[model samples]
Target: MQAEPCDQEEPPSVLWGLDPIFSAHARLYVRDILQMKESCQVPGIYFYRFHPIFTVDVLGTVVYRRERDDFFCYGVDDGTGVINCLCWKDEQWKQQNEHVKSAPRSLASSHGGFNPVEQLKKLQQAQRSRSQLEIGDVLRVRGPVQTSVQGQREIMASTYYKVEDPVMAVQISWMLELPQLYRKFYDRCFQMQESDLTDSAQSAPALLGRASGLLKDFLREKAVERFRPYDLLQKLVPLIPDIPPEPSTQQEPTPQSSSKQLHQLLRETLQLLQDEGLVFRKVISQDPVYQVTELDKELHRVTRDIIREDSKREKYAEKGCHVLHVLSAVRQRYCPNVSKVVIEVVLKILECNSEIISTTDSHYIVL
Candidate 1:
């Protein structure tokens, strides 16, 4: 198979031109799904409280398989977490699955040289053949993740494609879909790795683990709502007790045991806490700050009310929303007892961490 080239000299700004009715789904790691909790008010909608959009794109390797006369299920792991994926029978997919399973393996392998046209064709072909994937085969699935009858979360895939390299697939997904603040934090960690620490006595993972422990302890002790990574690291590093010499007579601690090992620990710790739903990056600023995941469900209720109000306004042909209207709705529905100043702070935090966008200072749009 050979892919055709586009005749247009310029690329389209939007792959499919701006149509308010159409929006691309978010791509997420399997770990993302595992971290969510069920919505308190909406009985059937699981974890509807976490993200503004419910649909997601998940990438992972198939670890288990189950097929029925009418449906099929596969367990997939993408480093962080594992999710059970269900694909209900669709005739079109069944046909594609059959074709993919029966196709010769030779067509899937690379030829001598890199051919953009050929590579594109192979990818297209791989899409059709995804249903034939074996254990360990990596795949990227797009669909709405819902809790099954058993209360286990599973993706009802609308479509999926074979991934040639799982590592590259995960890296690409994280780079493209992770929040800007989180991405920058990860990049800084990588840059720190490329520093003189590479020549240190401790391995990178070991240093990361130690640093994560120290940062975690500090966050717990301070009980602050949020703090910059650099500032936290500066304070936390001094408190990290120096490692005792094994012989008790050594002149100095090993390089790995030195405070220099704290390089990426703060961010690494934040990432871990985020995964466990204990903490999250309060992405309301350029420098990523840390915040604890609140236990109260008030924020969730306020968010849902705001979204409901936004939807009602959207039906009126309004292009943007006023922040005051949302804040008023929040106060009326969920926080009648809270102060105006407190409500404003909550809205600003939501604007930063949640998907809501600020069109102007007081106007907004939900992503």
Candidate 2:
């Protein structure tokens, strides 16, 4: 007898071994992910800008619901839209959540629920132990973009994290991401000549050379602890003997011969000094002020006293003493004359040199 062909078919094999240049997933809003289109050439994968490696991140709230013994689903809404995410059970996850899954399912009854109070407590406790998350908690998810045969989109999550500040998280996400987008869009939109861009960069360095010496002399005057740009400009212009005189006639003035032009030059010079670590700028009441970075000179003169006081107290062996202790000791013994700003700058330099260590939110430690 002739054999009939079997109707049963094997499951489709996934492309599991496709490696990417960057293992790091891209941070994307839920709207961006949902809007992606499938690549014409690749099956079961989504693409953005025609690139197949479209892994992404989404931060949102998820509502938890138990789907099976080995699975659960979360309906995540990230302001833009909602997505149904499926989290599969790994061996470790299954082991950790065994107690919750092993609970009797007979407790779920049709009429008046059986053991509803007891079941609710067990589920809540299980959720805490398993995901350490509750329904409606804001979370950050990282995963590959997946599109099913029926046009439904989803993310196969690789990592999940609880977000503490959603606003800060969104702001930080755009802060990091917008630069790349700006470059892509602006470069295409305004195609400037390479020579023009290069010339613009070179002009600033030339200005820096002319103004560097004058800036050093102005700072040396010690007229104030810090100077706002306008106040500093008032005192600084006279010191620059080479500053071009204002145009006398109605004739158009050369670029080098205007005080208005010098305004921009002075601003760029201060920025250069800041970049070179020769000065520090801080904003006060919406205005930025510049301070010379010369605390090391004073610190060098009193280094012996600092070490001696630290040794007497055995502070070197423990977490370092606070800046206040060293400041107080230095003033009492050697230099009775010093500013608080000078002392703080010296401590900051020591921290940078690894002579001491300070945590993001804590006191310094001796190293």
TM-score of 2: 0.33
lDDT of 1 by residue, 181-257 (tens): 33333212211232233233144443554455555555656766566667765654542336332324447544574
Which lDDT tens digits does candidate 2 get at residues 127-169? 5454544686766677777866675677766776556664676
Residue 147 error, candidate 1, Å: 1.1
Which stretches of candidate 1 lie above 4 Å from their native place? 1-24, 43-50, 93-128, 166-367
Worst 10 residues of 2 by lDDT: 7-16
Q: Any runs in candidate 2 off by more than 4 Å, and if so which?
A: 1-23, 63-66, 93-132, 166-367
Model 1, position 354, has a per-residue lDDT of 59
- Provide the lDDT at 298 for model 1: 54
Candidate 2's displacement at residue 60, Å, is 1.1
Residue 238's lDDT in candidate 1: 42
**For model 2, how many clashes?**
1
Q: lDDT score, residue 158, model 1?
A: 86
